[model samples]
Target chain A: MKDTNDWKQICSEYLANVDAALVNATVEEKQQILNDITIHLNERYHELSDEEQTWEHYQQILTDLGPVEDYAELLNEKSPDKKKFQKHRKAFWILLCAGIGCVSVLACSIGFFSHSAIKKARESKRPVVVKTFPAALDRTVDPDTTEITVTFDQPMMNFSWSWVGGGEHFPETTGQPRYDKERTTCTLPVKLKPGHWYWVGINSEKFVYFQTAKHIPAKPYAILFATADKNGNPTEIPIDYIEETKRVNSK
Target chain B: MNFNNWKIQLRKGLLELVVLKLLSSGQFYGYEMVKTLKTIKGFSIREGNIYPILARLKTDKLVVIEQQVSPDGPVRNSYAITEAGRLMLEKMTAHWKDVIETIDTLTAGDTK
Candidate 1:
């Protein structure tokens, strides 16, 4: 059962990475690529025998698909006039940077007062996690809890969120993360094992998709909790507590 | 360059041609196209690599995609070659034949 779940987790993570790599594609293009890949994966997975359905075997399938970033490069190459557009955009940025450099020199000559103003604006705009369903560091969350809800202080961009963290400490997500209609509260469907400790991070340094409408990433937050056993008893921490905690913290 | 690397590059270049030729026969879903290609010895391609080519062909008006419902599963994206694709394929095939003939003529005197 655990092996089956692990393979599913691997598949989910692979798809998410592919989605992340397609930064330059249009919405329609990204959707089509993802949809086609999903169908291919599903069909191949179903072809595997029960004994061959392990994570290693699933990873072999992903290997045959090639690296995820290559898809982005391939799409960019195929898109008409992409190279020309990129070249023009590069020149525009270079010119803009030169102009900014001149303005910066002038600002430094005059007081450089805008530095603190810019910092203040950034700090004010940064989003925060207002609340979580089980609340961070809860010791006795019900094992049957099917979802983790995170509420943000400000509205977020739809389809943008990073439920970051991995390994045995991380909860296995069953479905994609989704934002509420208001785009503030995001829910991630998860499967939790009884008496197991789970840690989830929202927006790490690398995977910072939990951004506000203005694209300011939320402050990194960790949700650590342990599920109660069938008897509703808070079970003892598993033997790998220290190692798993270290792994989660490192992320 | 390594022989394997050369073969890989050659295969990559020929993949677009192969996909067009496959679509010329009949419409196929992304998975079906990949499976069929994998059966061809020298023409085998990574499963994920086919989609981008198909997407590019669609963008170039060489192929059209249709949403199809599978009898046992979810909707599938089926691909078929357009008239423009057939014309392009004809030219590619002719060019390929010429290249093969030229190579054969050039290597005809080689003892090895």
Candidate 2:
């Protein structure tokens, strides 16, 4: 006899895999598909005898249904692939715009520094540039906002940052450095917690003017802004950020 | 070209009509519809596969859903053909008869 655990595990895994495979299905379509599958599986299980309740029996039933991708394809075909196509088309345009924006930035930065202030700055060996938002150790920012952008004086060939210290490690950010048309600024969308200190190590290893070998690692930067409370007051701390004295550290 | 491909093509073309005709007689859930269709040769179907077709029919307002509490399990979503579905079936059936008659005339005495 199939134990409850076995049934639950198998059914859930199967459903999860099928759901993951159906990328083109709408929310309602996916829910309806899952509901239908659940009812059918339950009916099938009830019809099976203890002797017949084996992996092989279940495998046969699932196999008869064929790959879930086939169903997705069928659904897409019947529904007139227009929605999925529209989505892809929208994404393509966004990517195209971003690409054009980056190229423009690179060109303008090159033109700006060809013989201008950049050469003088290089000769003096001053901090190449100090530009970013939550501008250099800023102390107050709205917690509800999802991004912190960095702008550089000179166009950078490459730039990356990581959380060195914070309430938690940097949450996964979406998208790459989106440079403005001027190439002087790039916006990075980050997931930040309210009322938490975050330290990020900034690295700009290459620049349009400098070669890779001459490139020096920039100073480690930190964003010290406290996210505001629900009432928009910077004074209050969110419940999640309030460290409990008695809390045990699992690590 | 091939007989199997031709069969599938024919079924694909006739699916909506067949489904409407089936539902015309009575209401059926996704699984029940699959099972009932399976009784016919060359009409094999896997459980839950009828849902997308049913869903499309629902969207086109050709069918309506009625929820029923199952004695053995949770509520089952059953589908019944609407008047619109019946009208579609009648038109499709007449068109199908004409197509069949034309094909018969074109292939008369060709069968061995």
Candidate 3:
């Protein structure tokens, strides 16, 4: 007859060994384990036959193991493999974040320098641009069509024109509207609906100077008019690749 | 009932019994087991934990599994108690009751 203390130790050993055994304890072995424990408990219980009642106390402890296997399964949920995966995942994220930070810093540095260069360029290009289109003022037109005339500070090559307003009221015309290897006087024909508003945006491929890095034409790209004013004067409207203003009179 | 020991283990264990009792009632898929167990306080379970023991029980054949298709995907075979499982539950429960009564009677200090 094992003492209650011994029975207690046995139960503890069983719990501790249970996981190891469960790693591969056949049902028979587990059941045998359970039986051995019971026999141990009962043998103790009977030894205290004079106090058979004391044996009853261990019965609960004995029955409880049945349910514990279920609970042990619960604790196993946060398995080591899963934990390792989470650690690897965390490291991967750290590396990814570092990569992103590196790219961001590189981009920011490039942007800062490029912006500085662009600002300097504008400062330098502004004077040259002004010299080319010194008469960057609106010329009023009254009917039939608007005539846009440009004078360059120097002879320019490769002149292009594109119409950007009033839907089909005035379709954009492109493909080297006209080129002047001499006076650098560039002009384009803009056809528009009378009594409608429109803008003719022009672009030239000439570098503001004979030696400049940029060839972008200036803004408000030569405003034109498709609409006739109250006095029949042409009223200019800005247009681009955006939708046309319902050609109030594409006629 | 030691506040910090065996009785605590027993209190925590009551839930396991309820789950086993339920499995004894009929086959229950893991989720189904959880749904049933939730109502009983100690038995509230983390779903993942149930499978390993069920697996062990399966190896033990004290509990057997029956696989069935489910829209949620391949469902684990549900657990059902075996005759040996029934016997075990019966014997353990008998021991559980005997112990409880003995404790009650002894702790009450009423030999009668």
What are the runs in model 1 whose C-alpha is more than 4 Å off?
A1-4, A81-251
Interface RMSD, all candidates in order, equals 7.3, 11.4, 20.0
Q: Give the per-residue lDDT of model 2 (tens digit) for A58-110.
A: 65556555445445545665354447656887998999999988886897777
Report how far residue B17 has shifted in candidate 2, in Å: 2.1
| Model 2 ranges off by over 4 Å | A78-251, B1-3, B109-112
Worst 10 residues of 2 chain A by lDDT: A242-251
Instruction: Give candidate 3 regions above 4 Å deviation.
Output: A1-251, B1-8, B11-16, B42-48, B110-112
Pairs of colliding residues, candidate 1: none
Return the clash pairs for model 3, or none. A27-B60, A56-B99, A73-B49, A74-B49, A196-A226, A196-A227
Query: Model 3 over residues B40-81: C-alpha lDDT tens digits?
Result: 665434332344545445554577766565695443446689
10 residues in a row with least lDDT, candidate 3 chain A = A204-213
Q: In CAPRI terms, where does candidate 1 land?
A: acceptable
- lDDT, candidate 1, A1-251, per-residue tens: 22667666656766776787687765566788889998888898888988887755776787688656457656766466455566787999999999999999899779865777898889788888888887765778999999999999998765567787776778876655666657799989888999887778888878677876556888787777788888888856554654554454443
Chain A TM-scores of all predicted models: 0.61, 0.35, 0.32
Q: C-alpha displacement of A197 in model 2, angstroms?
A: 64
Q: Pick the candidate with the highest lDDT.
A: 1
Using all chains and alpha carbons, the TM-scores for the candidates as numbered come to 0.54, 0.51, 0.30
